[model samples]
Target: MNFLTKSYLAYSHGEKTVSPWVILKPLGWLGSVIVGTRRAFYDHGVYASEEPPLPVISVGNLTTGGTNKTPFVEFIAEQLSRWGLKPGIVSRGYGGTTSEPVVVLNGRGDRSVVGDEPLLLSSRLTDVPVAVSSDRMADVAALLDHDVDIAVADDAFQHRRMVRDVDIVLVDATCPFGNGTSLPNGILRELPGSLSRAHAVVISKSDQTSPEALRRLKERISHWVPQERIFYSRLADPLWERWDGERFVPVGKNMTAFSLTVFSAIGNPHSFRNTVLKSGAAILHEFEFKDHHHYDANDLQKIEDAARKSGGKAICCTEKDIFNLPRGYVPRVPLYVPRISALVEEPGRFWNVVVQALRPQIVVASNGYGEDAIGARLARKAAQRFPQAEVCAFPLVGSGIPYKKIGVRILPPLSKSPTGGIIKYHLRDLYQEIKAGLFRQISRQLSAWNQLRSSCRTVLCVGDAYLLCHTLWGQGKKALMVATAKTKFISGHWKLESFLYRKGCRKVWTRDEETAVELRQNGVAAVFEGNPIMDLSCD
Candidate 1:
């Protein structure tokens, strides 16, 4: 371990007292305050969180390092797929070199490009699509092309910008909470109280700790979350396979004479060692590297030298380490990779919670007062049509008063523009709105829609072409447009607007029959829905 990790572990475990305790304790307190305050922003609505259109399952941990997130994510994806749901995985690509979102199709992307965890997931779950990007919203948007019905986000506990339907947090059984302190002084990324945000808490590596200790940990965790939501899991099913210049093939334990030199670049190298030992193989020598370490020619050479000197018939490492190895560098010694899977207790109940979160959603969006009126009716119509699905509203112009009046839930509110979304009539107000951060509002609105609009079962856009543009920004599938702002008796829609309607919308509902007929002549799929906006005044 490095000096920082070593010191952190020592302090957290209460193993040693350091001279810098005076300095470290205060800093840890400060960190806790900052993290808590930031969370409060999201909790109290000071910051806006975007709700995903599709059901999103987030696997994250409160601790700084691995709590076996990748294995659990794999388990979730496999389960979702078995249940007939087209699931996709997204990661922040922590330790990757790429900036743009890279889709891992058929497990083809390089580990160096997409990061080790995502590449490993893609390789194992070949049928499941994986996307890696710093902006996870971009990753979700990219997955839409694959027709994914749901998404599983890896290591996204604190990524509250995009709200998850199901939040599954993993806690290490051996070190559930570090020394009861925050980071820099301990291992906790946040306070134990954050467990309240988690829909389910998983005690990972449950086999690593004694039953008595595990029970006590559960009691402490229950203070923050419900006891029924807590689940136990362990990494099980250890197998050894050898690389044959193409892929790993199952190898017998006797193939290496039961002696191996094990090396790994993972968060918990000791866990890997324990797994190897469980296979009844004696470890002759061991090489350990930092988590996600990139191995070069020199590193490989040293590992090979150690294997030969120890007289070990084979060199072994975890499956994740294979990706970090130098490309096409064949080792002189026989190389083996250990594959392990997570075994969760009461899997049926755990999966039931996940399945429940996969419920579909409908989003009603509008930009103006009259548009909001139409959107309110659409929201009611959607709620009546799909009673089992969630119905919500996204107001692009102001606080969704119309939706609020109708008792429909509204997304995070944005600041209203100076002209109240009527910039065309009062062009001078556009400059004033720009000064009031109109561009920023538009960007935020688009980002809000990108995930929620993209994953929603249906999108109802009520407004002019400008609102339609925002509606379609994140929606991969076509949307239903209720054009309330324009009419044929006045000035009709422009050619560009008609083209957008024909190409982007599945069907456009006009305020009057004349406008619908005019749009039909131009090959647009238009319908006269009888002015819902006029009915608003009658009510």
Candidate 2:
């Protein structure tokens, strides 16, 4: 819908609520079925999920608009940056017409191309990168650079494909939960019980509630979640800073005494109205456009006419609305903006919830080109599933260009084939290996294996059984064996190498069921799973 109609707003607010809610319940149920089906697609891996190169913390709420999702996203970015990490934002730019990903705020153009939230984020957050695209799953990675430590996905709780490491769901403290229905009938986009998908829950606007009410709110959320996962926050210190074309001047008693014209295009205009009244500003006239409204010459002229009619001396608005205001068209009366910041009582605890989930890294090690491709594929999967853990690669042979392309940390001692994969030149390559000191290369390979052993919590050996033997050097270490090159029926030389598989790596995945049965008969813990390399190949 282009706008929230009066009937829907009345229904959402629980005024004249019943008959309309009953009429709309079937549609809400339909919304629930669709949402559930999508969630099931991701859960069962029917539709694939993609994770960014780094961890992602999503800021979203069940209710449609009033939760202040944008401001909370800013709060997360600031907090993540404070923890000595470079953070960026990926927003599904709702109002912009562009389909391609655009960097709206990085010391360049304004909000018109990237939508209001991104432009607002860029303006408020200096030196941070913000990318806007319709398909956040496919485009979020472009927003992040090699230096970005983590990413914040704005309004992405329902975006199942763009898998996030930390899902932080915000609840408006007044209602605590939704009006017990899904979209159209009420405010919730997903079912209320879906809050279980969140790793942490923040009850926003908590300051508005009394101490006893706040305690009850947390307890209520705990009914669906553990108490430790719940946190509280509010929009504190609402202040107006008057912009006189150049600098910001503080709004004071004298400023409020003058009759004022208010203009806002935020999701919750009532909150802005309350903040304006709190500033003691006398409202001469008020104009609220749709959320994220793009203003033009006509909108500006209407504001001028309204101010003239109401005899208001100045025009006031929220900081978000300033992004969409027409360029070089300052009204006759000055425009003042109300600035509100997200406040949390325990920021440290909230950050801890996010970081703890990202701990303990995964490492993939392989022997050759085929193995390296398989290792790179598994590393990306691990990175997506375990957002807190760093997934790295230690290539035993070859240049490891494939791992590098996927953003895997390619460990050194870069090796290459003498004839670049021409088996006809085997004699020349054998001579090259001898000339380069094959014994020294072996020693270095052993050292690299030790480094992998020290760095990773779990080791995945992709290609050769020699790596499995070398990687199992230390006790009390976890490892998985992928027999990518092995067949069910093999020569004596292959069977001799198969003995190393019995050295007790975790479950081994073989290329086919018969290979798994043979490995098991030979006293190795093996199972038939499809090859990882096939998933990586374009063919």
Candidate 3:
């Protein structure tokens, strides 16, 4: 282990010295705060998320790698394909120096150009399209171009920019949350509470840890995720493939005849070595490299020399390491690659939940930009609170740009006037709407709502009494209203508006408590849950 790795492992094991503690702890806290704030910005719709038309299932971990995300991604893609759905894989080409997206299916995947993980995915998943890019949105678009039914994103739990239909978070069974601190001091990318954003949590490599430790880990995870949403997984079904001078072919697991020299550049090298030993092969020499380390000529020379010295028949490595090997350099000894498949407990139940999330819908109804923001925020809450629901937006006024910004689906285009529906301040604005064919737009929107209302279980109206009246009229059901236009601090709701609130809406959330109190006095179910408009500023 290097100095950095030693220090990291020390911190992960709860060993802290005064000097490093002072420096790294504060940095970790700052990182946690930055991530937390950024997550809040995305959650409140201050930051826009790109939503692709096809369903996306993201496999990610809260920590910095070592949670078997890649294998689990492979598992998901294969499962999706088995179910007759065309699945594509998207990854951040971390090791390679690629400036743009390289689609493996397009034959643009050079190992040094697109990185090892993407190449490994491309080679392993025969027909699956693998797109690598630093920009995940670009990768999703690439997958869309390929006419893929679903996109399986690798290492994207913290990537709030792209909205995911299903978010699967992986936790390492041995060291799950990594001492409970953020990077530099520990391995956590975000706080453990962030697991609440995940639709499901998979405790990976479950067989590697003690049963008691696994139980404790699951108990701790249960604080954020429900017990039913938590699943256990282990690396199983190993296959050994030996290079026959040109390509690797599957050789049965009876490797006891040959003494092997093993080397790997992966998240968990110890696990790989354990797997090698379990194959009944004798390991004469061992080498370990940092995760995603690119092998150069010197690294290859050292490994070959060590194999020669140890009198090993073959030099063994993991499947991922094969892509990172120096190009055009062939090893004199036979190169053996061991591939492992992830086996999840109760996989049927897990996939059932993932498929079910694609069903239910939540419609956010709004009339203005401010109302759109409020509705978008509410949509985000509904998404997080109820991961199964597909949250979307229906703007009564101008095109729902704010909803689109936050990755909320805009039901249908609505006509816009020069005044943007602010007719109360000027009659000239109403004339602009009339000229813009507001009546025709209203008729189309009502027809669209009638078509959509039956599919949606919940509708959130985020405007004035006019919007509430329209939403209730269209849906033929009481909607949860966020009364953004009228407040007691400015001008309280009129008696007619109060009557509409009482009769039409299920609940009204006001901008201020005084407005809610006044509306409550008039027999309206009004609530003051702080001002959502104040969340408009990302700062």
Question: What CA RMSD would you report for each candidate?
Answer: 9.4, 14.6, 14.3
Evaluated at residue 360, the lDDT of candidate 2 is: 57
Worst 10 residues of 3 by lDDT: 42-51
Tens-place lDDT per residue, model 2, 1-539, is: 22346556667656555644467878878988888887655443344344456667788888777677888988888877877888888888878776777776543555667777787787778767887888775456676543567788898988876657678898877665446677766677887677776879998877666889888878777877678888888886666688765456787433457677888887667677776776677888888877888888888788878988888778888887877777766667778887778887687787787776556557787877878887888888889898877887877677888799988887666777554332324687777776766557667766665444313446678875666655554212435778765576653226656666764455788877787888788887888766555755653
Stretches off by above 4 angstroms in model 2 are 1-4, 18-22, 176-178, 244-258, 360-539
**Considering TM-score, where higher is better, how would the candidates rank from best to worst?**
1, 3, 2
TM-score of each: 0.71, 0.67, 0.70
Give candidate 2's TM-score.
Answer: 0.67
Name the best candidate (by TM-score): 1
Tens digit of lDDT per residue, candidate 1, span 1-539? Answer: 46776565667645665644536888889989989887766543344355555678999998877688998999999988898989999998767877788999776877777888898899899999999989887888889999999999999988877767788999988777767778777778899989987879999999988999999999999998889889999987677799754688897544335788888888777778878887788899988787898888988888888888988787888888888887886768888887878889999898776566556678888898777877887788778988888999988887878888989999865677677888776658888888888988887776676446323556778888887766655444466788887888778889988987886677898888999999999999999867867865565
lDDT of each: 0.81, 0.72, 0.80
Lowest lDDT sum, 10 consecutive residues, model 2, at 448-457
Candidate 1 lDDT (Cα, whole model)? 0.81
Ranking by lDDT: 1, 3, 2
Clashes of 3: 0
In model 2, state the lDDT of residue 96.
78
